[model samples]
Target: MTGSREALPDVDGSGLTLGDRAAIALTEYRNGNHQALGELVREATPLLWHTVRAQGVEHDAAEDVVQSTWVALVRHAETIAEPKAVLKWLLVTAKRAAWEAVRKHRDDEKRRTELPDDSPEHPTSLPAKDPLPDAQVLSDERDRILWSSLQQLPRRCQELLRLVSLADRPDYRYISAAIGMPMGSIGSTRGRCLAKLRTILDEQGDFSWT
Candidate 1:
């Protein structure tokens, strides 16, 4: 008992992105801090969850696909060229993974057709198909109108506005990271995007950003 080791103090590792933490933890794992890698996986899951769902993968399959994406991340962590760029890589990877899940669903349907009633293909073939009555449809139509307006901007403007609009991170680091630009440029980009958005709305004849 006299020679027992002392316990370590707990530390909260905040102010970091999941990708940044994952990259650091991955380096730690390579250097022998095995437990840290697990922490990275847990932290990064939510981002992947949102991204996968955003890509139209249903909740359950998106969960599985995201888990597999992390597993793959661990395996490929060493190959990432720039740790600073990890979030974009993760997003792109999640999008690709989500699409892959969708492709698998389609393939499963094709195979089930070949195999008959024993295992009728996965039920995720159709996206959420809840029917909305007239009022609900009009409301949805309004949202679509706004979304379509955003898309009508030039490609750069569209990407920049989407970068700002879709981000939940208020720190701006995440948006800067996603867009591969300096943090200082984000505000200007956002302004230009807003102007373009307003112009699009004004030109629409029936809508106005005001």
Candidate 2:
């Protein structure tokens, strides 16, 4: 993780480049300056953001990839032969993580899609529909449609949505830690996923929320 990394934009300092900050931060971090680690995150995050995004990863997944890259950098920072090349190292790491996330996301989507193809529609819905008032039965039917639509989302979105639902509305920190998602991004990702679900439902025009 060394060689040819350049200075990041918008993180100007006292005539120092982002690469320079990285070197100083690495040394300070190794020398017991925990704050340097924070500086490192601040300095390199934007560069990593664009690096990962350029690979076609969505914003939320890119956030997670970037976070993982930083974690990896912290673990392997000392292995770098050239601390001055830290920015390049970070870009490489983030890009690799983004590619990995994309692959995994696609694989998971394939598996889920295959499952649904082999399984019956209403697999979890309309199973011997419980005897209920007409209104409740229709409600359950609409809810089932919503549930199925949620599954149609990208795997990353499905995972975050499932975790959010399971967490009983606690702080996303728990979900983030459990799933390795970036804590700073859980809310927006959730919002986007839910919006996707609603959009799908709206396109069908069969479910009325009002």
Candidate 3:
């Protein structure tokens, strides 16, 4: 699924956080409003993909995990006890799925290593190194610089910043649950992350992010 960072909607004035929309979406889906769920998927897929990838799942596996997460949501819609926590549920579910994928991959690698080499060795097929769908959207010089700067931060900071960028409005409660960060520290952590990013950008020379 191709997406442009530039195309992410500005929801600052909407008076509704992504988490809020997620709750409404879940409630609507449970009431048979399937289109609401579809809309939520489009808005939230990027966040889910990043959340999965942050768990160390590879791109292909991350895609599968994200898809399965949505499917899981559908399957458990009626059973979800808190519609308001739907966003956190999705994040946690995707994260667990990603961990399972990583574990399975390690197991497969171990099994391959244990197999006896009775026949001629065959060349291993490497997955194609395709640019990530969202990465492809960073064609603009500023966007490229910003992304590179993000990479320079610590892994947790990178994950936090990416998640914050994807959300309409950062919901610290859900973000904390998703990333295993302290609920009270998310805001300050994000501030420090942004400060570090800005410092990196400043060293690269002044470029307005605003």
Query: Which candidate model has the greater TM-score, 1 or 2?
Result: 1
Encode model 2's per-residue lDDT on 115-200: one tens digit a residue.
54444453321114212345565577677676668768996776566545533354344444434556587677778888998899
Which residue pairs show backbone clashes in model 1? none
Off by over 4 Å in 1: 1-15, 110-124, 129-210
Error of 3 at 57 (Å): 1.6
On residues 71-158, what C-alpha lDDT tens digit does candidate 1 reach at each position?
7766876676655455566766877888888888867866766544435444436567322346655576456666778767775665
lDDT of 3 by residue, 90-120 (tens): 9889888888898887677656775454233
Candidate 3: stretches off by over 4 Å: 1-13, 114-139
Q: How big is the positional error of residue 20 in model 2, measured in Å on the Cα after superposition?
A: 1.1
Lowest lDDT block of 10, candidate 3: 1-10
Highest-lDDT candidate:
3
lDDT of every predicted structure (CA atoms): 0.62, 0.64, 0.78
Write down the RMSD of all candidates, one decimal each.
10.0, 14.1, 8.2
Arrange candidates by lDDT, highest first: which order? Answer: 3, 2, 1
Task: lDDT for model 2, please.
Answer: 0.64
